[model samples]
Target: MRQRLIGGIGRLLAGLRSPPHAVLAHAVFPADEPLSTLPCVALDTETTGLNVLRDRIVSIGALRLSGGSRDNTPPLDYLVHPGIRIPARSSAIHGISDTDVAYAPSFALVAPSLLGYWQRRVLVGHNIAFDLAILRHEAERIRLPFHPPAAALDIGLLYAGLKPRVATITLEAIAADFGVTVDGRHTALGDAETAARIWSHLLPALSRLGVATLGTARSLMAKQRDLLHGQAGAGWAIGDLLPPHRGPQHEGAPHG
Candidate 1:
């Protein structure tokens, strides 16, 4: 009893010391509520490069969804001056050169707006960890405490769950499977909007599979990732199953 009390106190103190914004960002989506009834933001980012430790976010795109209705609120689309040269390789993918963002606001100036858009909502993304990692790195650079949404839904992971035996899980592959056509494939806003549409299509299917809530969906994704890792460890070359695409080169490349 005493040890539990001490642990609880420690957690309380840590929470107290955390930034108010961070505190407010905590979210728990009840299992009883249908996913379509929950509020969420689909987000995406274009970066100078794939290295979260070294690269910077060049742009962000996000749109809000709630109660089965996508708010007509214009998506938040911001171009940021990354304060570094945009590599030619990455520029070819997202088409944002240094000159395009030279006059745009720096991350520090735009952080608050981004946070405002993200606060108190679940975040959805294609390859969400990359975007979140980039955001966290940017906040650290500016000495601001960054708190990501407590819950996130990754469409890529969900797609992986749907096709566990498949080796590759690119956004284009999943989008094609669901018949979602995104005009500007590599652009931030375009990808985010595509992800939103994918989520709409996925929700009902997920519901049929007993993933009717955010928490269940997250759990299902974890299981799917574990299965993929196990398959890879058994010398299954999953990448051989699909063609290549240009996106962030990370642990799960070509997916987001």
Candidate 2:
């Protein structure tokens, strides 16, 4: 009891010290809410490079899904001025070039709308920690308080948790596993849509794995974090993307 109280106090203090615009304004969904009925923003980012510390987001693609429904709206796609030269190798992979974003809006110009869209929605991505790290740095550039969704989910972590023997967890590999075709390969919107579909297919299987609620899903991710630790390309743990006050809450241990 004393330990729990001290931990609660520590979380409270951390929340108090966070920037005024901490992403989580309130718990939009309860910890016990069914993962199947959870609203989520499936998102992806095309960036200048893999190094989160120095790289920048060249484009962001996202599609929002309402609780218990499939995506019905067009994706929110943006090509932002990354404030850095797009490396040739990076452009070769993501197909975004300096000329393409020459007239694009700066990250500062798009941060408000992007942040607002992410509010009240669980952010879902493949290897989400890297994307979150890049976004955090971008927000920090503008001195904006940046915190990812308290209930964020990583498909890579979930897959690793469920299929520990799978050697790769790339979006394309997982998409193929689920029979989801590669539409916009390497494009932000295309990958986001594919992830959302793959997530939908994984929901039932994850439920069978004893991951039915947000908390259980988080617990599973926490269990699988070590497997995905260095996969983010800079040693960023999956949990590093979690909010300061919102450590992974384990309602119950996930079954194999």
Q: In candidate 2, residue 214 scores what lDDT?
A: 85
lDDT of 1 by residue, 127-188 (tens): 77668767888999999877666466677777777667777677787788889897778888
Q: Which 10 consecutive positions of candidate 2 have the poorest summed lDDT?
A: 247-256
Best by lDDT: 2
Off by over 4 Å in 1: 1-26, 226-256
TM-score per model over all chains: 0.78, 0.81
**What are the lDDT figures for the candidates, one per model?**
0.70, 0.73
Model 2 Cα lDDT, one tens digit per residue, 1-256: 2342344334334434556454456445666888887888888999988777788998888888764356665456777778889999999999888988876778876666666666777888887777887888888888987756646888888888889998888888898898988898998878888888888888988999988988788777767644443543363434554535443442332211
Superposed Cα deviation of residue 87, candidate 2 (Å): 0.8
Worst 10 residues of 1 by lDDT: 240-249
Supply candidate 2's per-residue lDDT for 154.
86
